[model samples]
Target: MSAIQIYDTTLRDGTQGEGVAFSVEDKIKITRRLDRMGFHYVEGGWPGSNPKDLEFFRQIRNERFRQAKVAAFGSTRKAGRPADQDANLLAILESGVCTATIFGKSWDFHVYRALGTTLEENLAMVADSVAFLKSRGLEVLFDAEHFFDGYRANPQYAMAVLRAAQDAGADMVVLCDTNGGTLPTELKEIVTYVREALEVPLGIHAHNDGGLAAANSILAVEAGCIQVQGTINGYGERCGNVDLCTVIPNLVFKKRLACIPEENLVYLTDLSRYVSELANKSPESRQPFVGTSAFAHKGGIHVNALLKDRQTYEHIPPESVGNKRRVLVSELSGLSNLVYKYRELNLGPERDSAEYRRILNELKDLEHQGFQFEGAEGSFELLMRKAYNGYQKPFRLETMRILTELRDEGHVYSEAIIKLRVNDEIVHTAAEGNGPVNALDAALRKALEEFYPVIRNMRLHDYKVRVLNEKEGTGAVVRVLIETGDGRKSWGTVGVSSNIIEASWQALADSFAYGILKLKENGAPDAQAP
Candidate 1:
C-alpha cells in the first residue's frame, strides 16, 4: 500500500483553537518532535501573520530536522494584486521554507461577496500564487477553501479552481471543509470527483464541527486521496480539526496503509500529551487511542475479559500507540482488577491474604465515605506500599498553623508555619502566599528542603475540590484531588474531610509522600530518612 502523507497543521491551524497559544520556542520544540516522529510535513505558521511565527521560522532555519519537511502556510494574494508583489506570498518566500501551502477561494460566495472579485479573478489568484511559489523552486500545495460547499453549489466552478491549481504546477491540491459541516459521504463523493477530474493527488483537511472530521478525512483517503492534514489532538478553531492521533492508527493498523514509520507510532501517546501540555490544555481522558481512559477498564466483566485476552475488550494493543492499559479499582472493580494490578505492581500478596484483605477493606471503607480512588493512583499506591511492603516515611510532620489577614493592598494574605523532623533534626519554617493552600505549599517546601532538597522541583499541577455533602451547608464534607508533578510526569492524590483545610492538607501531604518514596527508591542525593 502506498503511504499516506501526514501533514501536521498544529503550529498554524491548531493555534486557532481557543486557549491554544504557543511561544516561538514551543513551536520549535513541537516541530522537532513531529520531525523526529517521522511526519511528512509540518505546517509552520504564516510569517505574515505574527512576529512569533516569523521568529519561529527564523529560529527553525538553523535546526536540522529528522524527516519532516517544513511548510509555510498563508492565504493567496489579495484580489487584483500581482502574485510577485503580494506581501503574503513574499512572506512565504522569505520564511526560508522549501514548501508553501496557500489557501484560495473555492466557494463562489467567498469570491463574489467576500473577496468582491469575479470567479475568473479568483481562479487567476489561485493559479498565479501556486505558479509563483513553484517558480521560486518551492513545493506548493493548494488548499481549495470550502471546496465541498462550493462543489455542492457550483460543481463546475469548484472543479475549475482545482484544475487551475493543477495547471499551475501545484504539487497537491488539498480540499478543505472550512465550515466542517460536510458529512463523510459528501466528502468521499467530492474526493472521488477530484480524482477523476484532475491529475493531482488529493489531501483532506476537515474540521470537527459536525463530529465527522476524522471520518471525512479517512473516507476521502479511502476514495483515493493520498494525504491527510490535521492536528495532534484536534486542536483548531471552533470545534477543532480532525485529530491525527485518531486517524494515523486507523490508517496504519486498520486500513493497512503506512503513514508514519511503525516505530514512531509508539510515540503517538506521548506526542498527543506533549502538545496538550505545551498548549496548557487538559488532556481529554476520553479521547480515542491516546487518551488516559482509551484502554482503561473499571468494570468487572471488562477487566476479566481483558485479563483473559486483551483482544476481548481492546481493539488493539495499547502499547502499539505508546499507551498502557489501566485497571482502575473502584466499587465497580472485582477480583480481576487485583489480579491485573498485581502483574504491574509486583505485589506478592495472595488473593485472600491478610494484607490484601486489609488493603481492600480500607479502600472500601474510605470509598464509602466519599473518597474516590479511581483518579488518585499516587495516593492509592502509597497506601498499598506502606500496608504491604513496609514503606518507611522520610519525614514526620510535627505541627502546622495558618493565619489569614487583610493586607494594605486590599488583598487577603495567608501565612503558614510548618514544623517537621527528618533524621532526628527538627525544622520550622514560615511562608506567606496569596491563599491558604499556596501558603502551606511554600511553608512545606521551606521546612522539607533542608533534608529533602530533591523536592525543590515538585510543584502542584492541578487542584480540584468537590463538595460531597451539599446539604450539610458550610460543614459539608469535601473531596480534594491534587495532581502534582516532579518535572517529568504527574500523579493524583485524593483527600476527604468536612474541613476543606484538613482535606487539602491530606492530599498535599500524600503528594509529597509519593514524591519522597519515589526519590528514596531511586536513591536521591542529599536526603535522609527520619
Candidate 2:
C-alpha cells in the first residue's frame, strides 16, 4: 500500500470559520495534539498575518515532533516584485520552519482582474516564489489556487501553472478547490490531468461548500494524488473544509491505504473530542466513526439484536474507532434492553421476575418525564440502584427558598436558603449570587461542605436548556441538563419543569445529589471489593 501524507490546516483555514478564534496558546496546544496523533504535516498559521502566528512560529522551536513536520502557509509574492524583496516571502523564510507552502493564482480571470497582472507575470510569481523558498533551503509546496475551476475554464493555462511550479523546484504542487464548488468527477479528471502534467508529487486541498470536500479529496487520492490537506473537524470559511476525521479513517480502514500509525488510529475519537472541547464547539452527533451517537442503539429490537450479535445492527464495531457501544434505555426498551442495561451496570436481573418489568416501567416513566438516559449514563445507574435495592438516600431535601429583590433602578439581588439532612444532622445555609440558580447552588454547597469537605472540589462544568413543549405558552415544559466534574470523573444529570428557574434548580439539585452519592459509594466499607 502506498503511504499518503496528511496535512492538517486547522490552524490556518479552520480558524476562518465564523465565530472561531484561537489564541497563540490554543494554537500551540492544538498543534501538539495533531503532531501526537501522527499527522504528517501541520500548517501552524500564516506567519505574516498576526502577532499570534509569529509568536507561534518563534516559540515552537524547542518542541520535538515524532511524526509530523511543521509547515508555514503564505501567499505568493507580488506579480512584479522580486521574490527576494517581497515582505511576505521574507516572513516565510523567518518563520523558522523547514517547509513553506505558498498559494498562487491558477484562474486566468483572477490573474488578469483580481491581481491586475498579466498571465506571464502571474506564472513568474508562482515559479519565482517556489524557487526563492527552495533557495533558502526550505522544502516548498505550491498551492494552485482554484485549480479545478480554472482548469475547467482554461486547461492549458492551468497546466502551465503546474509546469511552472515543477520547474521552480517545488517538492509538491497542491491543487486547491478554493471556491469549494467542484464536483467529485471533475476533481478526479483534473487531478489525473495534473498528476500526468507534473513530475513532482501531487497534493489536494478541497473545501466543503458542496459538502463534497471529503469525497473530492478521496477521489483525488484514487486518481494518484499523494497528499491530502484538511482541517480536523471540517472547520473553515462558509460550509467548511474537508474533515480529516472522516478522511483518515476512510483511507486507513476502507481504502487500505497507509497514513497514520496503527496505534494512533485508536486515539482518533479522543483526539476529535479534545479539539472540539478546546474550540468550544459541540461535536456532531452523527459524525462518522467518532460521534457519540454513531453506534448508539435506542430501539428495542435493535438493542436486543445487538446484544445477541453486534453485527446485527452496527455497521462497524464502536471500538474500532475508539468509541463504546451504547444501549440507550427509552420508551422502546424491551426485556432484553433492560437486561443489557443491567449487565452494563454490573448487575443481573432475576429470570422471569417482577424486577425486570419494574425496571422497564421505570424507564418508560422517566422518559415521559424528560429524563433521557441515552446521554446520561450516571442518572441511569442511579435509577437502577433505586429500583433494584431501594438504595439509601445520601441526603434529604428539607427545605429550599429563593428571594429576589428588584429595585426601582433596575438593580436585582438574589439570595437562596437551603436546608438538607445528611444521616441524622440537619444543616442550613444561605448565600447570594448574580442569579437565583447560582445562589441556590452556592447555598447548597455551603451546607454540604461542612460535612463533606470534598464537595469543594466539585463544580458545574456545563448547563444546557431545552424547551420540551413550546406550544404550551407560559406553561411550556423545559429540560435542563447539567454536567458536573470532580477533577477525575464527569457525569451528566437532567431535570424538567414548566418554569425555567425551577428546571435549572432541579438539575442543579440532581448534580449535587449524584456527587454526594458517588462520594459515599467510594467511601463505603465494601468499596474495596471492586
Best by lDDT: 1
Using all chains and alpha carbons, the TM-scores for the candidates as numbered come to 0.94, 0.93
Residue runs of model 2 more than 4 Å from their true location after superposition: 349-354, 487-489, 499-502, 518-530
Task: Please provide, for model 1 over 403-507, each residue's C-alpha lDDT reduced to its tens digit, 9 standing for 90 to 100.
Answer: 999978699989999888877788888999999999998988888876678889899988999998899999999999999998877889999999888899989
Clash list (residue pairs), candidate 1: none
Tens digits of lDDT, candidate 2, 146-236? 9988898898998899899999999999999998999999789878877776789999999999989999999999999999999988889
The positional error of residue 332 in candidate 2, measured at the CA in angstroms, is 3.0
Compute the lDDT of residue 458 as modeled in candidate 2.
92
Q: Which sections of candidate 1 miss by over 4 Å?
A: 353-358, 419-429, 527-530
| Model 1 collision count | 0
